[model samples]
Target: MISKKIGLVESIASKSNGLDDIRVKINGEIQRAYNYPKLTGEVNIGDEVVLNTTAVELSLGTGGYHFVISNLNNMESNFTPGGHIMKLRYTPLQVKVDAVEEQESPYHDAIEEFESLENMPVVVGTLHSMLTPFVASYKRNNPSKKLVYIMTDGASLPIYLSKNVDTLKNKKLIDSTITIGNAFGGDYECINIYTALITAKEILKADVVFVSMGPGIAGTGTKYGFTGIEQGPILDAVKKLKGMPVAIPRVSFADQRDRHMGISHHSLTVLNDIVNVEVNIPITTYEDEKLDVVKRQIETKELDKKHHIVYINNKNTEEDLNYFGLSVRSMGRNYQQDKEFFDAASSAAYYLMEVCDDSRRENY
Candidate 1:
């Protein structure tokens, strides 16, 4: 049974993109809570609300916030038109979306006509923080290119939870978004990653595609036991569809953990042991002892021999980010604090830019 508790809303902290961050008092204790206005409608001060406290009760690292289940004052249900197929089936909020592959879907013809990704460059990253830097850098270098983001359900289920995504879309950094596999709230909804990729190529007419989870990646501090393991299969999916797979290696020297330093264990594990397909791994030029550490890790894992390791100069990434008026942070560290992290993502974008330019020259 799920543990739930009734709480009184003490104050509304902030509201954005259909989510409300509120302060609540439950059993004489103050707790932070998140409320989805789409489901429960708008909540207010002094309203009594029911919360799913299972994660918080277990001290789970679910961002340390309880989820607002329902407000006693508002019990109205909100429904939208969708197909017969249901995602999250048997759950209370189980929803049917008009998946593009569905026969009854309006996009069925376009989806059927889509034969391949046409060697479209798809950048796959393990963290949501990788989204902004890559998109901003790509847009800065090639302003005319149309980029689409395909968010997988490996992390946060609700796409609205990502404030970075909202900022990127508002600034026109990304052309559109598609949420797949039980993740909700995007410009379009797809049943799976394959359909999402097709939508990017056929419908959106995107020049490049970026794939990552929303936010709050789950890690168990053990090899092969993290949510980011999905990157392995996603790389395979892109290759099977004839798309060019450019992997964003999660590089960091600021992290205190040994597992996360240099090329993160997550990236090494996925690339070396998990993903079987050949992927383009880009490493940025950096002058530091940590660079040697990363090189040793790559050589030891045989990543250089297995994958096409490309060296890129991302020295201008800071300039591009500044031009777009965007600042990004991962694990609470900014660009200055975590330069290698952002540089790794920017290097992938740089590689894509070169590929696009080369293709254009050939076409001309």
Candidate 2:
């Protein structure tokens, strides 16, 4: 496709009779070389144009000295005599960055905790795209909880866990061998629904599992990630497991965005129709504390329980949220929202492990 950038060299907006006419300069030498007549009254001075000759049409609204041309990559944009110069950039509909640092992470709280744990709990999250860091941490800590990870790409877990065995043992987190598995799939397919069922099973087995992966830059939206999957199978899966499904959204640096709603928060609403487990949804807003209120309501059962949905108000203020790097986007609202959603997912996973630990001990 011929990528094009249109720019307005010059323009003058004027009214003749009842009609409006705009005149401007065109910079594309190709236009003159191709014997194309100059665009008359179509633009004004210092206007910009952007279009791809083979891709999409250039649409400039209102007054501007606009001109269209192909091959923006090879040339620099400049102003014309009658119109303003224009620059063009390419953007994809969806792009995901794993951002796995080759160097060690500067933050070491999780690592330190894992190193100190005698029985490490399994941490679960949606997607296997960019969890190299966590996996590495587990290996380094070598927790006894098997350092198990449930991922969408289930086929690959066995291999990944095996490779990390040495590190896992060295961290002294594992008194025994660690194992990982892919129950459903290995990727982030049907995260909310799949995890609800998986958590149920894990609970029945007396295993603690943590869940993360909310709406975020992780490219796992509700529609394509977890909540969008079929409800019937999800229900069946949870029924087979016979355990409660908790929704805990983490407010973390790895996740924090404004473009999308929290996946865990949304899961509460969506999963209510799918399963019967007790949910731990967190409600976050830009203003007042939302999750704390929800948590109190849940404790009092003041919130409607006619459905299985429950919202846990996080006792975090906006400032606290930002302190954890859970701030919304100053510019890219969508990206920031997505980040928040995913962070919630990770936090939910961590919380689940804690809750499960307590539940298992009580039952034991």
Q: Which candidate is the best by lDDT?
A: 1
What are the candidates' C-alpha RMSDs? 2.1, 18.1
After best superposition, candidate 2 residue 87: deviation in angstroms? 48
Q: What is the Cα-based TM-score of model 2?
A: 0.33
Lowest summed lDDT window (length 10), candidate 2? 32-41
**C-alpha lDDT values of all predictions:** 0.87, 0.32
Candidate 1 segments whose C-alpha is farther than 4 A from its true place? 358-364
Q: In model 2, which runs have C-alpha deviations exceeding 4 angstroms?
A: 1-142, 153-206, 209-236, 248-259, 262-269, 280-339, 358-364
Q: Put down candidate 2 lDDT per residue, 68-165, tens digits, no spaces.
A: 43223233433234211111113321112111111232222322222212222334333322232233322332233433333332222212222222
Q: What are the TM-scores, per candidate, against the unseen true structure?
A: 0.94, 0.33
Query: In model 2, what lDDT does residue 114 have?
Result: 22
The number of clashing residue pairs in each candidate reads 0, 69
